[model samples]
Target: MKHSGSLLIVDDNPDILIAARLLLKQHYQSVKTTDNPFDIAGIINEQRKLEQPIDVILLDMNFTQDSISGKEGFYWLKKIIEQDANIVVLLMTAYGDIQLAVDAIKAGASDFIAKPWQNEQLLGAVTAAFSHAKDKQQVGKLTRQKQGLNQALNTPNFEFLGQSNAMQQVFSTIEKAAQTDANILITGESGTGKELTAHAIHQASMRHSQTFMSLDMGAVAQNLFESELFGHKKGAFTDAKADHIGKFELAQGGSLFLDELGNLPLEHQAKLLAALQNRQITPVGSSKAVDIDIRLICATNDNLDQAVSEGRFRQDLLYRINTVEIRLPALRERSDGIPLLANYYLKHFAQKYKRSLTISDDDMSALCQYAWPGNVRELAHAIERAVILTEGDKLDISSVVGNSASVSTDEKTQSTEVLNNVAQYDTFDLDILEQRTVRAALKHHQGNVSHAAKALGLTRGAMYRRLEKYGL
Candidate 1:
């Protein structure tokens, strides 16, 4: 297959230009020759306009103006690099001196090729130069992408704040662990702010200035596991139209946060273990190994110890990732922090919605008492929802959490009675049974969608769809 890289040969000798172009054109898609060295810039700009920027250039080291010393080649090379450092240049001269070759490389030329070069030698040099140029382009692209992501991530002030003793312990651990490069394992229930904790650690670490890439292990499909985390070459698979950089490569010299890590399949866990153990990854369909240097941080809601006992999670992999385990407490377990978190979100959403709103002491007390099944995330959603729905200046506790969130024993009994009545209406019809079951779950959980979804063995999204379908 012909390479996509465009090639240009610039020489005062027409015979040399013709000979080189003829040989390169067979291997490359676009090969152009120019006798005038001054036309290099215009040709490069024209190719870029055509959306096929010049990738490699072969320039004679000795032009008519400065034939012996190769001074003209250095000038043109400097000019070419200044135009775009990504464009690979191979300096060519009949009088090839070893020191001149070293100087050519130091001045940004990709390689030095002697004139009257063998066909094989010339082809090899151009191929290597093209590869180097492509690598440089990939690096440049990743740098820009990382910069944009960092900007977006840094927009919000680090809000991983809490005053509870449990959270204080977590913060202390983070402070100690962030100084080192040990892999960190964060385990907690859903909505417990595992990703936030990971980000906090990344921000506090020595790699704070570098990229912090977060990958959702559960969201990645089983078939795409290797390609997604380790990367893939162009034509690696049916849909792989171009060489793709994976999370491991993108997070190089930074931190990699693997969220929902317990959901990784047992088979894929082995591959992850290998990469973590070796500190390198081989992109899919490519034999070359790319070394990686990243601070590994993984979060999961699943009980990995139990998983290991059941042979669902590999023990060796767990040992590799869990060098420093930081277990985040459930919101109910750290109720002291609820007031701080609640007020923070309250003020935030109040400003966001342009409402002059305040939470009453009774509502704040109720928020602190409620057993938040979905943890801090649930609290945030509750505050945001209440801020949007409340009509009064003071936030309503009933609106913030469900009506039954901190109800008395009598109210709890009444809610149970309502759930019993909902179950009494069970019909054999699948739609009716499903709707009734959903309503009963919602009533039992005091209208907490996350808890109700869990009770019915449904995802939050699936539960929302059912709620919309039944208009409930």
Candidate 2:
């Protein structure tokens, strides 16, 4: 799979830098490295020219044997954050100055790792930081899109564009909720514009002038959940060479929108509840708590009530984060909004790619009829693909909608064969069937052993050997 972001590792120790680079190179296509923190800004400028933009920074607090206080790294962290608040910075902290890491977070570090860190922990931190950075970037992109749409319409300002009763009620609720400090919970299926709803509430609220930060809970790993949400101190572990800050700290005096909140592990939910109740959070390895002044806005696709009934989510956490709840209807549910959203995306993409395209009535009808399982995201991607593949100004729905018949036929045939085989073997042992299933999945994913193993509930090595056994 292609990674969506790049990372930059800065450390004075050549060995540490090399190790970090080696570890991240497999996951990220672009992993830049530098031993001197002073060269960071220049390197960032150079890397921006590359096809893929750098998304995260890992900085070591202490530079060399002589500079013990990590003041240089601390200054660089401030400068880098000032230059680009979007980049996620993970501080490398040493064992003795963990307090310094907490201070560094207050100064602007995204998260931190301790010295002598486990490989899994380091990887987890990087992944979490990069994921958070990507979410922030998407929020910024959406804000710009809304602004551009307003400019195109010559409107006084951008507001949610819908006249339906459902949307009118949503607007009214948002306006009323914006005046209070209560945590608001927004729920809907994917691509129902939950993030947009969050942004609208933020813009309409008393904290409009303050920074707005959003995070996707579904993207981060289970192990690093604590460090990513609460942050960690320097030397808190082996990889901690500097101090770091958590999301709660960064969202101080602002609104923290936790998107896809239902995806968070049950273990992390309790901690989050405590933070919401106390209005403060302590770094993962630190004992002291930092005060935070911000409103919480959480969104999720899954039903938290169902999750709690199933014991997969904590009811207490849900109660804490959802003082006010709003549910956005899916595109199909709001059929009247389909043409509006389609026109919005159509014009947006046309201008973005410098084309004069118009959506015919026939094309609009097809878009409305099609089941958008992936919601607005799928719709946007479909429009972009259609625009790129199209030779003329008008979009042809035949080419843009659904897979080719030949490809669909092949998939149907394969699925039927798999089902038939399982049915024929009435006495089949489930364990053996599972092993065979793993091998087949590996072959289907083009030998992506890890993904295949995950899908089949088997270890990667076990899946690899099964493939060999089946001569796949």
Candidate 3:
């Protein structure tokens, strides 16, 4: 197999350099030989200039004639490490001993090799050294990437809080699922805290101390999907000026949250599936495939099953990502949960804005009654907005009730008139009430489904179903 690693063999004896080069050249992508030890620094610098640093170095212990103390090898070893501490160095000498090997290793040499080594032994040693060097390089690269992404990794401090039966079941599932390395798929409506749930799982998992990298598939351009998820080499494309570590590598030994997975293009789903199935990824413009150890957690607001049936999604990919599926209920479906979330965000935003604020019992009741189409995220935003706008100590229901938004007095009067007109029939039948309410809302909103849905405390999907049911 062709290797992407580079090897450098340095020996004072021309014959040794020639022989080692000839043998290692077949296995390594780049192999350099020099009979002069002084050329080591120059050669290494040149490789760095080309962005292909040496992976392993075979150094002779006695570079000068009649010198056998191996101090020369130790000197160069220190220099190599000084240049790049992660580079693997192997010491070679004609006069070899167990003590020399011990001393060489203690001085940071990867291994000790005796002169006139067998080809198989030399190949084995170099291969092992190259692997070790690659590992170190990967770790260093990930550390740097983590430093760069530290600012973007601002995870929220709140847990997924809900007391309704649906939320209680979700909490139970999260606790159980976090115990294993199984891939988790969080399905929910938009603004339902899918990303937050992913964070909760990562925090609850054994890999809590490690990274929790999140990528919003919906926000990423389709053309950049592979590069964004699997990473890319420096100069991989017109804009790839530097090597970029993908989310998979950054989330090594942790959780990788792929938000909006259903938005992934069908053509790109195969690439993701291949990586997950193989447990490895080949960066764009690079032939080497890197093995990754990450617990995968994906979230989506779209109905993937319907998409799959419509041929917009792949069934196999769906199966691969949904080993444990946790669907978050819509805000309206979470019975008595809105008040809890609203109060939580109220206190949170109140402190954030440095204001003392409280929600009245009546206003809180109105908040509990309205259907939060935007879910917890919307509720948080609404509370924050109220906290910022309300000048009084107590929150005003004028802005917090009926869709959790500020509606003009005229609009409120018109909507109440519509509801009152619909209730004038005096029929206590729920179906009749629902049909009349849907019609009235649609009329009041000028046939705008979104506005009508929000005013009626219903999701767009629920609104559409009602429209279809009542033939409105």
Candidate 4:
């Protein structure tokens, strides 16, 4: 088969150079030969300057007189690689010096062939090496194109208010982490706006323009976790009808928010830890690994240290994700920011619903005083509901305070019951427990499926299915 790639042959022997050049010239488009190995650098440089660089190099391992150790071959290989590392360097050695040839390959040579090789064997190796170089070039081009597209697309913007000192500190840490490419772990109780903070960091960071993909780890099934995080090829599994780009691949050059991370089981944590540590992922049903470039931001309501002690979370994975840990203050703790958040939600909902609604001082006090087990999320729902239902200009405190207490009480009771069931029954129906947990989360977030899903460390799709299953 004829190859389009150019070739460079370097050897100390005139006969070997002439014979190899004559043999390879028929198979390749351009073949350059040099008997002095010292002149290989100049030859490669000239080729590079001409914009017709050699694609593959056939280098004799023992180029110096009385040099059977192949040190000269290794030195020239290093020089060639330094000039252009992408070029394939195939080493040639005497038939009796096969080990030396193999060692040269280990040092940097791409491949090795013995002297007096079959013409067909030489031709086949060069073709294969040329094919690999072309494939690498094509892949590099595609990666650049995809990265350009990802950076060009518009990403959603978010604004975070942090009037309270606790929140101000959170903002300060966020600014620090945003400047550097650090994997961040945001921790707090439910409804603390971990996801919002993640968006804030992404919007303010250097990768602000790239995609910000969010995945709820808890919502994904155990079997599909790999497919969801690292992607899967077509025919990877029974349901993998088409190729899929996992969150890690999709969030290239940007941020990936793995919400509810503590929900990942121990078995799955190993897979996640491996991908993160290696900075690469192999899609399901594919042996080839794809390199990933991402800034990770993860959120978890669970205390990871406690979970690690209990054997629910991996210690190594914990260390990997939390390069910089930022704890967001719960709503009750940030009293100063409550009014701002409340009014923001009120104004937003009022305009969205086309209503004239204003918060009363008494109502603001009620919002500030509430325990807010659901944090800002519960408060936002209270404000939005009041905006939708209240007819008068000034919204009263009764609706929010009254409904919140009842819902909070109900959630507590339901949680206590579930804990009791788990502690008492050896074979309790998991469906019933899941239903109760879903209901409590929904009630806690005031029937907002998305918020409730976050509170439950589940994906919205997963929460929706349960809502239907339990007929909530």
Candidate 5:
């Protein structure tokens, strides 16, 4: 397998690239070279998408014409790992730069070589890496044997549903990280389907056939954090009538999704970090260290960076879990996807409740226009409520957004009265008055043009021109 593996050598030096390519050509099935380190991510992603990923990357430690430091190598190594940890990278450096290449190992490079090396030394390192790759693939297969394999595939609610560009990047990240045993940290505002995304990742992963266990850190009591995560022996405590397996043991060889990760107790952060670092857990009242195998996925609405600054979180723990970070786009950022999500929820709940329902175009537009402060969760609840309450087959969003986005029926009547006063002004002085009125409305709204436009009975674009014309 090592002999048949594909190899990618990235270096700014073409002569060295040619020599390395020629040397490895006899053993490796394919040898590709690139002078640009920036293009490696795109190349690797494209290769993985085509199911022809490179097995190993021989990377140079320096790139700048006048530079000697291996900073360039570390940058590319991180980029490569962020894309896919499955690709084994061996950093290449001259004898004087050997220390820098060694530093790359801490940055995720599998191995490093001092250049002007023997042919046998490089071959041996590459051979060992392919063997390691084979072992890694076997671990994935072993994890896939865990219980509840089909449950994930059958659950439609766990599906990743989005066609927006943001979601495309998310899906791509999932594809790259899922196959590897990398710890993934998913970040987003609440109700953006963080758990759903975690489930989707598990389903797409090599561990899909295994059990996907999840626990809400915010819901778990501070006292129960240890017992819940690391199991409890019988009679370990007053409530421990029977031995209980923890999430760690239950999800062994699979994935454990820790939702609300930021809510974990400060007292227990160090314990959790130690267990993760050592890949071992000690049960309550048990002296034996239990070997654990779990791919970790954690999600949080709270900012951990802020938490670390406040000394509430362990920075080391953050580094351990965030091997790859996937940030989900909020519904407001991907407003175009609202109709799609709305329709999806409509059909799902409609079938569940045995109801006939459809959303009108005007209603859809209103739903999209309304700022979803609560993200997709609010939109979903609104749809479900509208479907259940409406007497007609079509959904009436009037009741849904009356207090927020849509103009109330009573307000419409009052607006009609305000329009009547417009003609009372002198026609020649209307322009002067219009500018003054626009400026006053904008001032009242604190220069929020959209609110000002709504207050002045003008569209946002119309308000823009009036502001520009008057320079207000």
Candidate 6:
């Protein structure tokens, strides 16, 4: 037999209670009813103590009055929601009081039905209410599960560890945006924790129960990007022997995080734009367009406006994807955050490596002075390295100070060389100098494209073109 959950119906009329019991008995394992509104809470509490709590409440409006006004029921609804926000309460209102029903919904009712409701309509509404309640329960269960798993996996703590005014504004903005279903575009320098911000938004949203899937657009190969995103039919390509579901399909009713979104190819951008505009997608080799419900959160380190002006990115697509834009400050720009982030990473790595280490004032000063071109990611790695290299509880700053001194020497030498070379010419070309500086940084990083690109303050694609132009 199918397992039918319990339900409680509250109304003052004995005939109405009997009718509700009969109507709901076919679907629920137990249909408890009360003709006295005063005893409703006691009955619910007693049943809950018995470990068979009500799954749904069919609350009648205007229990004491014959008139159709829902004033009395509204107060009961508010009480129920305040007492147990998890309980699903469906209002029973007259046809003329639909506006009142909507008001009840805003006050926290799961749904409402009118008097003289048809059997099919009533059943449908109740079924929908049950489904929503179950979904919420499932999400709560999953959150607990994730928390346990994270504990076991020993993931790093993710509090927004920053005290800068810019960071404060960012936090405030995120708090305001978390209450709605707006698509957010996060722009920042590389390693500035854009993905972390996306995770925070998902954690704060109503749909946090659903899965969160992230894809790095820059990492995906151009030829495979479409198949990777939209899935593929059996025999869609040479490698596809079976059907594959895309990220969009997997993130249905959840979130799809597109990191480095500006790196998406122009052709793929058009397809993505269509999906965002229509909430539907077609697979690589399929003619059928599958409907999807997803909240898109995109991040990019590149200047999207410049890409749009260069005709490499679509302007309309940008507008559609960026309903809300959040800019994350670079670590160097938010200098005040350095000490906090450094200490956070220190404690984190110390626990991971089973060491107890402390930073001296000199070490702290050295960290705050350096320009972190690699942002938080680099800082985290540096702290991990230091933790491993140090022998005692106190970290030594000699290595860090020496590295800084070497970098300074290299910069001064390069500056003098640039001045000497430029002074030989009557006219200095800014573009040529910029290209040379980009080339030198690429060489210094030993062709590690991403690091060199960051050092030159250029996107990877832009860096690649400069590398080719200078034949480096």
Identify the candidate with maximal lDDT. 1
Least lDDT summed over 10 consecutive residues: which range in candidate 1? 149-158
Candidate 3 colliding pairs: none
Go through the candidates in order and give each one's C-alpha lDDT. Answer: 0.83, 0.73, 0.82, 0.77, 0.77, 0.76
Better of 1 and 5 by TM-score: 1
Can you tell me which runs of candidate 2 are displaced by over 4 Å?
1-160, 402-472
Model 5 stretches astray by more than 4 angstroms: 1-158, 403-472
lDDT of 2 by residue, 1-472 (tens): 5476778999878888888888888888888999887888877656653435568999888876766686877888888877666788988866436687788778888777888778899989888898899898777656644543342233222235666678888899999999898899999877667877888888899998876777777656677777767877644666654345667776678788887787777778888888888888988667678898988999988899999999999989888888999998776677677788778777777778888888776557557655564566556666776776677777754455543222344553454345335435644465477567665777788878777655453434344556776666
Q: List the candidates' TM-scores in order.
A: 0.63, 0.55, 0.62, 0.59, 0.54, 0.56
List, residue by residue over 393-450, the lDDT tens digit for candidate 5. Answer: 8776665665322465455344434533454668657778888888898889998987
Q: Write the per-residue lDDT of candidate 3 for residues 36-116, one digit (tens) a residue.
A: 878988887677556687789999999888999999999999998886777899999999999999999999999999988
Provide the clashing-pair count of each candidate structure. Answer: 0, 22, 0, 0, 0, 0
Looking at model 6, residue 106 earns an lDDT score of: 90
Q: How close is candidate 2 to the true structure, as a TM-score?
A: 0.55
Q: How many residue-pair clashes does candidate 4 contain? A: 0
Model 3: lDDT to the true structure: 0.82
Candidate 1, residue 285: the lDDT equals: 68
TM-score-better candidate, 1 vs 2: 1
Better candidate by lDDT, 2 or 5: 5
Tens digits of per-residue lDDT for model 4 on 319-407?
Answer: 99999999998776787788888888888778889988787665565576666766776677777777777877887545666643223
Q: What lDDT tens digits, residue by residue, belong to model 1 across residues 156-233? A: 332787999999999999999999999999998887888789999998999999888877776577899998789876
